[model samples]
Target: MNKWQKIIGVVVILALIVANVWAVMDYIHLADTAGAWSAEITQKSFFDCIFSFRQHFWFYTFLSIIDLVIIIVLFICLWRKGGKQ
Candidate 1:
């Protein structure tokens, strides 16, 4: 791969790694909460609703998968291009 492609690929992989780590931490936090799973879903005040956000584990997983794919592709490209003039 060219220089820019390699840089972009590395950045994506790093971003995915960070995202996955954050997701794991979030899952662990939710798991540790005594009543998190059992909590009732109720309507919140407008301000509370605006500020409260839930994390999406699946999104992170998808990103992680994509990152892995990019890394594999870059490695394969480098291997195939080796020894070329």
Candidate 2:
């Protein structure tokens, strides 16, 4: 892959991993602290923020997969271009 595409792919993967992890953490925290969750909903606590973010878990995962596909395509394109040269 080109340097830029590779960098983007890495960044995307990291972001997705972080998001998924946060989703898991938020899910667990919500389950653990039942009453506190509503307070968080009112005040917008960290766990609440994460809870909102969890909504995009599937979306981010899809984007991460797309990023991987792009990286693969980039490598193939670069390899073909190099071969022609």
Candidate 3:
């Protein structure tokens, strides 16, 4: 990848990390309010709990899956390149 492409990739990864971190923090806060840790809260599945926000679950879920796929594809491409000049 060229310099610009590498920079863009880093930005994208950082954005994804930020988004996921926010979701995790939200989950922790919710679980805390419910008086239990996430693992101890068995009333709902992890996805159900995470996406329990005001019906934007599908949107976030889609974005997360897409982000994961993009990361996987980037890694595969890099592996195939094998450090070629």
Give the runs in model 1 whose Cα sits over 4 Å from its true position. Answer: 1-3, 34-55, 83-85
Candidate with best TM-score:
3
Candidate 2 RMSD to the real structure: 8.3
Candidate 1 lDDT, tens digit per residue, 1-85?
5899779868876877787788788766654443344456443543244234333546666767787787788789788888575
Cα deviation at 13, candidate 1, in Å, is 3.0
lDDT of each: 0.64, 0.67, 0.72
RMSD of 3: 4.9
lDDT of 1 at 62: 73
Residues 53-77, model 3: lDDT tens digits: 5344464687779888997898999
For model 2, the stretches where C-alpha displacement exceeds 4 angstroms are 35-85
How many collisions per candidate? 0, 0, 0
lDDT ranking, high to low = 3, 2, 1
Q: Tens digit of lDDT per residue, candidate 2, span 13-77?
A: 79767866776686566555544535444544655755765656566577667668868987998
